[model samples]
Target: MTQKNKMKKYGSLFMATALLTGALAGCNTDEDTSSSGGSGNSASGDVIKIGANLELSGGVASYGSSIGDGAKLAIEEINAAGGIDGKQLELITVDNKSENSEATTAAIRLAEKEQVVAMLAPATSGNALATVEIANKYKVPIVTGSGTAPNVTVNDNGSVNEFAFRTCFIDPFQGTVAANFATKDLGAKNVAIYADNASDYAKGLAASFKETVLANGGTVVAEEAYVAKDVDFKSTLTNIKGKNPDFVFIPGYYEEVGLIVKQARDLGIDVPLMGADGWDSPTLIDLAGAKALNNTYITNHYSSEDPDASIQKFVEAFKGKYKEAPNAFHALGYDSIYFIVDAIKRVDGDITGEAIQKQLAATKDLSLITGTFTVDEFHNPVKSATVLEFVDGKQQFNSKVNP
Candidate 1:
């Protein structure tokens, strides 16, 4: 053979071998099966693994732990009843260390490593934002149980991230409702704001409340901020006292809110305290005492006393298990899991994140323990919020507001 011809033949043969090797490497094999035990098919004998990222330790551990428990309960129930698409539901959970970015990263790593089909997350807004980018990168559907910030799904590009979803109502509506109740219902003209500066939930709710109050011709006489871990609020209370406002607005979780209310009353500031859903906890009454919690108004998801069948069933089941009535956080956590399960049932298959997201977007009129929820275009829940007043150490449902 001529030299050029031999060279061309050898090159062609080498190219053909390389192509064959690449094709063989791309073929699916038993070793290539996912650790989730599935061959990427629903008919295959595989356990569907769902992941949970929450704050099992740290400052907000109490709330996060409860959320994790609620999710586990839902998974248990589903598994007992023969899980979605005749597959067993497996739950994987990790702690995000109560809003720490490093902890969130670690939890995301664990979920990704486990190859979870979907993930439920950190019970607060800050941690939710911290982990969302990672979930988006991996294309895992994450449904947060307690993150209420308006930006949870709405991005700067005016497009919703396909991987992100939430089960709670946004902060804007809760803040607006609180402000409206303060102005129209409570007839309070001058209000003072005490916000937790460290929490995105607190800050966002406070800002929304301020805007709504101003729009309703209610004047904000004073504004004070504090960190989440700070227990002493005497300084802020002293400042708010001088303003002589008709009421005080505290946008923070029950832990800090209870302390703030107790200390405010101790400091001889007797104005009624108003807050958002963060105040919905049994511990709040015990921490703040009946005297401090008296006349305090807050917005919440569902009341245990609600006559609705769904709410009643959840309350009974929760009380039977935990020996205490479930709080708004617990209800939201429970509902979030069931909501995701319903989506899974709707899109029956090898549960992919994209499939769950599409199903969630189409969710409408889902009757849940919290309330009837419909996922809006922005992925926010359109539902009703119940207004509760702590009177005589009990939460009394005053009214329900629809958004």
Candidate 2:
């Protein structure tokens, strides 16, 4: 009846399903795709399954990999410390391949076939948006780590999506921070916007940036758009260069953002670039090179350079496990899983999605590796954002902006 015995009895089916699904999706087996490591248990079938639907492969795989690492670390620690009630945590992670359709499919598979009580949505807003519909339709609660676009959890009519929740600040706050920093601190008067037209995340941040820029007595000299997965950005950069804006604002994932930075620098555009949390990934530096990323800035959820005791502890633990410093996505993912587990404990080990959702709605002042914040009515976290400046290929802490 213990957790280990329950998993030994029931985990075969879960393992088989995961293997079959991974084969079909061509997912990486070596990664921490699943965790069921509880060794001893005293109750029967005391295993709590949670779904992780993320971009584990494809353009934004870096985000998925880092987030997965963070979540895996948290789950390991939770299970080691004795899981909620008597149940051990089992994370069944699936790769959405960084596509909206794949995210929807992954969510469905987790909810129906995998039978996860709750879901951790993808790191990107576009993918998270697709999962939102599936989560609501299947009555499953889905939480996101870094899907900051406003509409990720809030519907178009300004109503909250009852089953959708996120642990990061929304696009408005992020965009406004970038704009405020550019205008007030950097003193950029005219700005050019290069946005990913194919991504809701990019479009939402771009819209907010433009609005904030205009309101702050700045002019948008030019704005160009590109679709996701587009490797060719010379034409867009050339067009933006013609306008000669003081700063270029790109609110997209690191895969494309890194390319844009390199291409822009190649085109002799020396203006500073600013971006949102989507820019937080190791792939960015790998693709763009350290020198090209110099003078760039991003609004993020956490800074690795923070000297806070809790922040330092998390950094050390993450580095010890992953052999690399954790990024904003890692912090967000770590906090998100903790948030879900905390809610589960508050409900006295109720593994039902409904009960967990109710507790998530009431989350307040929960201290996390990222920061302490409460869930607002729209299911968005009201937390502070750190503006990080990339200098010599390293992210240095800048100013902190509160929402």
Candidate 3:
């Protein structure tokens, strides 16, 4: 062949090699990138990215932090055990600043930017409700550790959102349980309820409690409302005291409940103080003192004193890791991670958000450390709750109330 022809052939071969290399690089760049935080696998296939939106700072900072820690512990344990499907779990957690809409927006950003497969929200009902719209829009599955309001899973039109689910029982069920315990077990014929009207959790619980109390032949002598951040309850307490009810039910968080209990007792309101699951916090006793907490009863997810094997194992593992016993929120937070992981394992392929949602909807009889959890049609846990009493500044398990 001529020298010019040989040069032309070599030039063509070089151009072909360059084109092939460029195409391969483009393919590699197009591959999904994984993240290193949150609950699910990352986008790059190297790790799973799970998004966590919590009230990590603000008035509910303590509760949010504890729940985030619990979720992190679970993720660490899962990673240490070889992770899900041989991929490292990454958490992309964002602090919601106790802003409901902001938290929801953060979750949406994580789903879009981080490309997370699933999300776990160890947050409040208000925040969870805000995020549910985004989850439904994007088909992202969200498992809430708290967020017990019935409306969390249902839209304003009363349609169930398949993407939204919770590990905790609904507030209505918890409220009914609390009311039954007060009227039948505590022998309280007349009850007064003080609810945080600003909180869906508090309002729902109070409504259900009032309905249950009246249905069971007991009366709600006084029903007062308060905002969550309000510290002064004397005015409300004074009004509640005028009713002279045998029991006072405060359906709110530990912070407000603690203050209300202390002020109520100081004002000579000696009636037994009853509350929902929100009262199961160490801060309740620390802030309210044992004197104020004495004779207080509250409904909870699980008790540290329970001898159940699942509960014992969880307590041991949690204490060994965090040097503290797990509360109801922590337990549920940990379980929420496992629930998502379990659903992910059951699913096949690229781990899209839609697949996770379907798997979550199909979840049945999931036996976690909390209890045997079965997601009802409304995506709420159909399980039993432990009734607890505050005895000498400690939560003592009194009995189990089944729904």
Best by the TM-score measure: 3
TM-score for each prediction?
Answer: 0.86, 0.87, 0.88
Residue-wise lDDT of candidate 3 within 39-142, one digit each (tens)?
Answer: 23334566988888888888677767777888898999999999987988998888888887788778868777777888886478888888887677566788
C-alpha lDDT score of every prediction, in listed order: 0.82, 0.87, 0.84
Query: Global CA lDDT of candidate 1, please?
Result: 0.82
Query: Candidate 1: TM-score?
Result: 0.86
How many Å off is the CA of 129 in candidate 1? Answer: 0.8
Model 1, residue 199: C-alpha shift (Å): 2.1
* Tens digits of per-residue lDDT for model 1, 153-198: 8875798866678988989889999999999998999999999898
Q: How displaced is residue 281 in candidate 3, in Å?
A: 2.6
lDDT of 2 by residue, 105-129 (tens): 9998897678787889998888899
Answer with 2 or 3, whichever has the higher lDDT: 2
